[model samples]
Target: MVDIPVELPAGPETVTGDWTVGDREDIVLIAHGAGAGKDHPFLVGLADALGAEGLSTLRFNFPYVEKGRRMPGPAAHAIATWNAVVAWARTQEPSARVWATGKSYGGRMASMAVAEGLVVDGLAYLGYPLHAPGKPEKPRAEHLPVIATPQLFIEGTNDPFIQPLEQFETVVSTCQNARVAWVDGGGHSFEVKGQKRPAAEIGASFARVIAEFIRG
Candidate 1:
C-alpha cells in the first residue's frame, strides 16, 4: 500500500499515483488506457501481481482523467504528463531503475517519448495500438524502429486497434530488444466472449507476461 509520490509540472495540477513498491527494487511506471484511471481494477490487479514478482509499480492518471473527460488528453499533453511522471520516478528512487509502460494510447505516448529521448531503462506496452480498426494503411509503428530500449508489447489477437497478425510480427521483429506476446481470442479490451475470467485476471495474465519478458 505504499504511495509513489510525484510532482507535476507547474502548469498542470498535482497528480497522485497508486503505487506498490517492491523491497529495494526498481519500478515500472504505468499509465492507464484511454477510458480508465489509475485505480481501474485491471491496473490495480496488474500492479499487485507485478509487486508479487518483486517489481514495483506506479500507476497514474492522465490530464484528461483529471478533468473527467471520456477521451484522453492530446498526444502532446500525454507526453508531457509522462515526462513529469518519469522525472518524479527518478527522484523518488534515485538508485532504482525506472521503466515506462502503459495501456493503448498511454503506451504509444510512452514510445513516442522514448523516441524523443525521454530517459528510461525500458518499456512495456500492455496493448500497443498499431492503428485504428479498419485503418491498417495508417499504422502507428514507424517510430518504433528508432527506439533502442528493451520493450515488450502484449496484444490481443482480435484487437481492432492492430490488424493482421503477420504484419504486427514483422514490425516487432525490426525493433531492437523488442518482442510480442499474443493473447488468444482477445478483443481490444482483452475480453474473450463467453470466458468467465474477471477483468483483474486478464490484467494479471498481462502482468505475468510482462514479468517474464523483463526477466529474460
Candidate 2:
C-alpha cells in the first residue's frame, strides 16, 4: 500500500494504491474504471499477470473512490491524481520505465493526463470508451490526436460504447501513434455473448498483448 498526494483545488488529498513489485525494471500504473475501485477483480488479475510477465504494477484509486462517491469527480482531480501517481512511480524506481493503463473511464483520464503533459513511456486502454452507448456523435477524442506516446486501444467488436466502428476508426486515425486490438464477439467489458469467463481471467488474458505492446 502507498499513499499518493494530489493537490486538489480544495486542498491536498491522498489516494491509496497497491504496488506489486516485479523482477523487471519497468512498471505500469493501472487505474480503475468509473464504476469500480482499484480492488476490482479484473484489475487485480491484470496486475498479477503483468507481474508474472516480469513487469511491476501499481494499481491505484482515484479521489472519488477514496471519498466513497459513486460518480467520478472532476477531470482535473483525476488528472492531478495521475500526475501525482506517475511522479511516485518514477521516484520509486528511477531507472525503470513507467507506463499508464486503465479500464474504460480510467484509461480515458490517463489519456487526458498525457495530453496535458503527464510523462509516461506508453499507454494501453483495456477498453477505451470512445463515447456513450448509442451516442457516437459526441466522441471523447479531441485530446487523443495530440498525445505523442504510443497508445494501444484493446476494444471489443460488439461494444456499443464505440458503435458504428467507422467513427471510432476515424478517431484513431487522427492520433500521432496508436494501435487498436479488437476482441471478437466482445462487449464493452470484454464479455462475450453466451460465453462464461471469470473477470480476472478476462483481464489476465490481455497481459501478454499489453506486455508486447509496451515493449514494441
The alpha-carbon deviation from the true structure for residue 48 of candidate 1, after best TM-score superposition, in angstroms, is 1.0
lDDT string, candidate 2, 1-216, tens digits: 989999999999999999988954789999999999999999999999999999999999999999999999999999999999999998888988899999999999999999999999999998899999988888899999999999999999999999888999999999999989999999999999999999999999999999999778
Weakest ten-residue segment in model 1 by summed lDDT: 1-10
lDDT of each: 0.82, 0.94
Return the number of clashes found in candidate 1: 0
Segments in model 2 whose C-alpha atoms lie over 4 Å from true places: none
| Residue-level error in angstroms, candidate 1, position 181 | 1.2
Candidate 1: RMSD to truth = 2.3
Clash pairs of candidate 2? none
Report model 2's TM-score to 2 decimal places: 0.98
Model 1, runs deviating above 4 Å: 1-10
